[model samples]
Target: MVGEDIDFTRLAVILCKPDAVERNLVDGVLERIAAAGVSVSARTDVVAEPWQVHVAYRDTLTDPGRAPADRPAYLEAAFVGRPVVVALAHGGPDIHARLRRLIGHTDPAQAVTGTIRGDLGSDSIAAATAERRLVRNLVHTSDDPAAARRDLATWFGAGRPAPVCDFENISVVLCKPDAVERGLADDVLERIAAAGATVTNRQQVTVQQWQINVHYWDLLVDADWFPGRDIPACLEAEYAGRQVVVALAHGAPGIHSRLRDLLGHFDPPHAAPGTIRGDLGTDSLTAASAEKRLVRNLVHTSDDPDSARRDFGTWYGARRSGLLAPLLPAQIAPADA
Candidate 1:
């Protein structure tokens, strides 16, 4: 929006406010947006500044009809110094409207069911007004193309330098829904950590169709392997709406292959006693074959460096660029005058 002419109809700026970061809802929130056909990217973590917030709310902050009567005083108190996550959501021209509906009413209490604010928000406008504060709604999207341009400037700031997307020493570990439902996520991650790799940033994700599709792209490509089953339907039935745990495993180069070996064969029966599947998994290929379903492996690790990047994006959401902070090379700051 700043350097190039952006197609506002196809792009919207998403601001996950401080409340979202504090409540740890940014990942799940972005996942829901993506599930609705929007593609989120370039998620940048930023600390809110008073001037930025003032600029972002220039049109409304001073209006009592839209904001608290004491907005000038409370706005900064609510946002300044707090961490916020911003990203670009790309979709059809209607994306702004769709996202607004998805996020629901400005007041969480008035927000109807099924919308993001309705389902996830807890604060109410009435309560905020009574307390002389701003409502703690979880997110905000550009009102229109004009606002998109301003939001892009206010939130995203200068484009982040391209991130170091290396994966030779990193792997994404997905504890499948089975493991989560069976209460084995901790056990599975512990095993990976026990294997001498550092495990961190563990997050729980509500399955979205796009995520399953992308992560299992090969399955869709080679659907011939499963006869008499609608691959998409089977995938939705198996994963959509289910919760899974994902984490990062870091070590020396080739950590991806090491983790895959640690996870063992997909079939529990075929996995050796020392492997994660052999030791903890309960489902088997034999049962799945007979039942016309896929095997329920307890966990999956990236197959290679490339797959690690794919897996990371699939489970973590594109807006979670901060998760790669550790993997990024330190910026060399110029000496002060």
Candidate 2:
């Protein structure tokens, strides 16, 4: 059944992840919100600086009963973790309350089943079960209308200016050889734009199996199966040293999740139908041979600036001669050719 209609003053959700947000799950939330006929007033992707985290969790810091040593570690853990913020403004009564209900609470146990956290979260340390809730939880919504109002003020300027622009940060997109070979580059880019992300730097790359083996080196060395699932095929000759595309997309709210969802997992066939995988994937599960089966997913989405820099170094830094010139020196810039 449809629920109460709430006009949000403005709300910001903190979405944290290991690397990238999952496709079908996050897309479902966006689709549900859109189906409800709500329009987003503003959106941005925020990487919580140390001070910001300290401020957000200020109340937790001084709980007198808590150990001082533990408090610092807790603060550090939450601060450095990769997070994305999705902020919005609405024009109806009880909007703040409604959004609070729509998205679940930060604590895993308290999150409502129908919300993003309930459905997608697993253990912050590990994905024990598809249904397991994490200490990280899937997402965070403001606690109450008052807190929502206050948070909007801090994170998004409380609607002083429009909310959906690209000034806050940037995106790094990896359009693998599969996309270029299948002629779906433009379609993928269009989906990214439709989702509100801007493309800042785009390039083509020719990568070797050994390079992928190195980039995913941790996976290669792991004796466990889950971590090693994609390594072997990544080494196959048919997939060796192929040309791929790379893009640095400017960050905005909604765009990051949208692009990853649209790109699907590394191998397209496993991706859901509405996604890029369903639309363009050539290798299906039933393929007769390894060459016939598509590798993991099509695109790569960076979790944060640090990850972007690290992965870009493994993939693009070794390839690009002078790209990303304006990036700050201390900002963990990607290595250059």
Candidate 3:
């Protein structure tokens, strides 16, 4: 259950439409949602099943006065081929309105200038109708509180509470091979605990090439990050066969930045004294380059909440039911206050 004082916190559902998925606009859409102060709770990439679409749009489909006979089929067709990202977002006060405003009007042309539909959407209702197709709006949000609850139940199941938003902040941290091999994992975890973050989950695994490749895909493309080298080969050499400690940490908001600060810079030599990298790591980028290897940075912390969720999903599947279940209110309450 949600905290009593914050009972007003609302939940909304967002569906990244198939066109957006095909265009690879999931990250940009998520960034806009986060910028609106909504925190993503749970997310999954799924191909919309016909039954699900009918269930989701039942009212619209059944209202003969509103929808044309072919509307349901057209809608289903639009959603079937590509994977749509269905996400639950939570926020304090008027969350439904905030998400609706962010998503904009049903028609791109009539939508306000600053909204997501206005900015990213290209198709108009008129154009779509003329072509006998569904409107290519980039995303969808529930119309009201009732609709939000209904859609959430339909999409994410009836009783499951959204995960990440249950905590003030959730972050994923990795004690990379260097730290694990050097037996510095405990020291790094101690520093995190000392900073007031709780370790909700911990697991040690020898990373796979595919997982590492997906995890660091963005970094692989950045020339500065992997200068003058084959990024995949380098990553394989450093991480693929090595064991790393992947930890999920929870704490107050801004925990990601806090942990990153504790972990210090990527290059140990450039890290400030007293930080984990500064204290435990000694390898330099220059030395690594000379040796044709990666700098032995001791730890990795997510850059922000979005990055944290994405990394967590990549490392651990999105449906994190038992993996690091959050503490119940009774468990955290003082015994004899």
Candidate 4:
């Protein structure tokens, strides 16, 4: 049954090697891969385990092919104990071949000018051979359906990845319309990372009315608080076709409130100096009220665990369940508790 469930030709496992992580090219590489029409998702960061890499490079480790006798050591030095990014790429039946071609040759020097390795890779076969090491090619993709099947088992723990749900440790970042419009999403994310959060899966979504309606359902329900403003109309006018950036932030427990505090006040003018909105935002609630629109607060973060889960669905799409990490023990108490 597990074999029956595999997408075979349509699915490939992507391994952004330690060098990619060290150089912070995971996002850029993944973006290029995704740009090639493959659906990239289930992104995860893992410290390379010897066995995992052994299984992944079984061909070289066992047979070496044209590789030198020191090839296994080179592979180990490049991957073991270092961090790498893993993801799933979904496409047509020829996805494996497509991705293989897209990544280019094993040696960056020999890779074609238009390919991923050719463009982004700096290390070469000659350099690696001289150093008695493997070339730092940046990424790896399954060779074909059969390889994809083995890779699924090898890297993804038999199709289930290692990221646990970790609600208390995760929060959703919603860079509101204003943030994207003003080109401040990157700055906002940078600040979040600086504050020691692991932010991933940054996505751009063109707001749908239904999504905004549900996201701010409370505003609609409590419209009377702002007697003159029409909540529904405000939501539609502000968000309905606008673009926003969404991301997942992972950290220690209490990440939700920590992020909320980091965002400062909902009304930028009232926020503290170091907070995200306080430092970057120009618009305020008073201005919005006068203009009959929603306050351009720059960003919104989930208020709690349940809110995070809902916000994940609202922005990232509910059906992409593979992206969520596994859940930790339910009996464990929150850190503050």
Candidate 5:
């Protein structure tokens, strides 16, 4: 029942199958979901354990007490050893139904064109049956609202105890256009996870001039922050028209600083090796200045709590409430009180 508080919104789960991930279709699948007006509230890449897969498809994996005995085993095998992206998507009251339709039928050949499976998938049940394998559909969505709730909990621990945070910090990390264009979004996300944070909300969007202005208002106007740097020119030269992957990550105290460290220095040449920018970025401030462009650092992170809150507001208004609201501490005492 964790996700059943409909009240004009519903929660759904989408699993980008291993084949989809291998084919690098995660971004396309997410884009389609967002095109349908669904927002991703939480996401994680999982190399699922057998038990997790069993829990995810409990009905199918159970002894059917009928024919087609090999179906369940084939399905289970398909899920094992492959990395899948598990995402929690929220939308209007009919979100569950919408996602099912968006993802398409279980058998790729039977799915209608334009749906994810029909567009990206090439395998069929008939061919799979002939090959004695499970249909290699590109994605999976909950069959119903009930299943959505169950799968969310199963994958994201909805009802489980919250992880303790020293300051209950939340920060925003943006994978800049260059990173996405280079197919480094997954690598960046993996590094974020490696740094001990959880991505609670994510969206892929083209950067707007106004949002960039607001995001860098201080650096643009306040010489104290940039020490005589020209704000407007910097903004126009770098972020004016670019695609960016925005994500909200939560962790213990100092999460903002932790993310900043992981992102490396603003200047790629000066960034220490092993950090995101140092590892992936090649542009230098001198070179960029000569070209009248901004350094091609691969990411952006909030510098502090205030900036985190501000950036979250600018990128995701009410949608932020879905993940942030539940994390707030309760004020009421227990009945024993």
Candidate 6:
């Protein structure tokens, strides 16, 4: 199940609570995946918006004459104070085995010790919420292909590998100080161009914990792994003072990988020397398992057409973005304008 034989099953590696609390736990699972030699196709950090959760779980509350309106307060209580991190990845070929091994590392009854949840967790929800604290649980993977496709589209986009000539993608990149410090941005851009990717927008925005949480919104359920404790305070602290670089590139299928390969993870220390990270990265944190260290292991791509359109709309404000735009748009625009 290696290479192209296996379908590119998209997995949403969700992180909820302990912006830092669960860092080690989640990092370990990712390390295990890397150990299996499974390459991570794409990754991103998104904070879960309460509204999005409300919609995703709307069905649960609206069953059999249940009114969703009645659940607003509950939604507010559950999400008002907390935010979650979402790590997105595409996996295939022995990933399940690797993931199972990681899960098995935790304390079975009490968070499955040795796993992300067990080692990092404490009073559960008490730390996250004064009334409650939660332990850090690492990663969330999408189950099955259909769910994978759906989840990928919801988070990454339509998963298209080709370019929409009329529209360009807004590639959001973070050139951590390490990249700039090492002066690798030029080479990174050159690589992106070589891979058929073009930059349409770019920015050097500092990352706030809340932004990370909002970006990774698909996580953050008050479930078994997350005891729904002191989440707000943790988020407040993580987001208070942080800086990150952002870029928006548009072009073709392999652009995201190009940048990822160049940036390495977090800084210059950890990246492969010839590659972008190799030349500029400066972190000891191993690459997310199988892949080499490059960037913070946090570059994102639109998983599908729908997702691309939605994300583009959010980032670049394309008025008519979607698969059905051809039919829905009042007038057809030139495909390659």
The stretch of ten residues in a row with the least summed lDDT in candidate 6 is 323-332
Error of 1 at 1 (Å): 7.8
Largest TM-score belongs to which candidate? 4
The reply for model 4, stretches above 4 Å from the true place, is 1-53, 61-98, 107-110, 121-136, 144-164, 326-337
**Per-residue alpha-carbon lDDT of model 4 for 1-337, expressed as tens digits?**
1233445777788999988899999999999998787767667788888899888998887774665677678878888999999887766788888999999999999999989899999999899778777889999999988887787666656533343466787899999988898889999999998998877667788999889998998999999998889989999998999999888888889999999999999999999999998999899888999998889999899999999989989987786544453221122233344
Q: Model 5, residue 13: displacement in angstroms?
A: 3.0
Q: Cα RMSD (Å) per model? A: 8.3, 19.2, 15.7, 5.8, 6.8, 20.2
lDDT, candidate 3, residue 91? 60
lDDT of 3: 0.74
Output the number of the lDDT-best candidate: 4
lDDT of 5: 0.74
Count of steric clashes across candidates, in order: 0, 12, 0, 3, 0, 77
Which parts of model 6 have CA positions greater than 4 angstroms off?
1-29, 55-83, 93-101, 104-109, 123-138, 157-337
- Alpha-carbon error at 325 in model 5, in Å? 6.6
lDDT (Cα, tens digit) per residue for candidate 1, span 26-61: 998988887786766556798999999999988787
Candidate 1 vs candidate 4: which has greater lDDT? 4
Q: TM-score each candidate.
A: 0.52, 0.39, 0.52, 0.73, 0.64, 0.37
After superposition, the stretches of candidate 1 with alpha carbons farther than 4 Å from their true spots are 1-47, 61-71, 83-93, 108-110, 118-133, 144-157, 160-255, 265-275, 283-302, 305-337
Candidate 1 at residue 153, lDDT?
Answer: 64
The segments of candidate 3 whose C-alpha lies over 4 angstroms from its true place after superposition are 1-9, 159-337
Candidate 4 TM-score, C-alpha based: 0.73
Give the Å shift of residue 89 in candidate 4: 7.1
Weakest ten-residue segment in model 2 by summed lDDT? 1-10
Which is the better candidate, 5 or 6, if ranked by TM-score?
Answer: 5
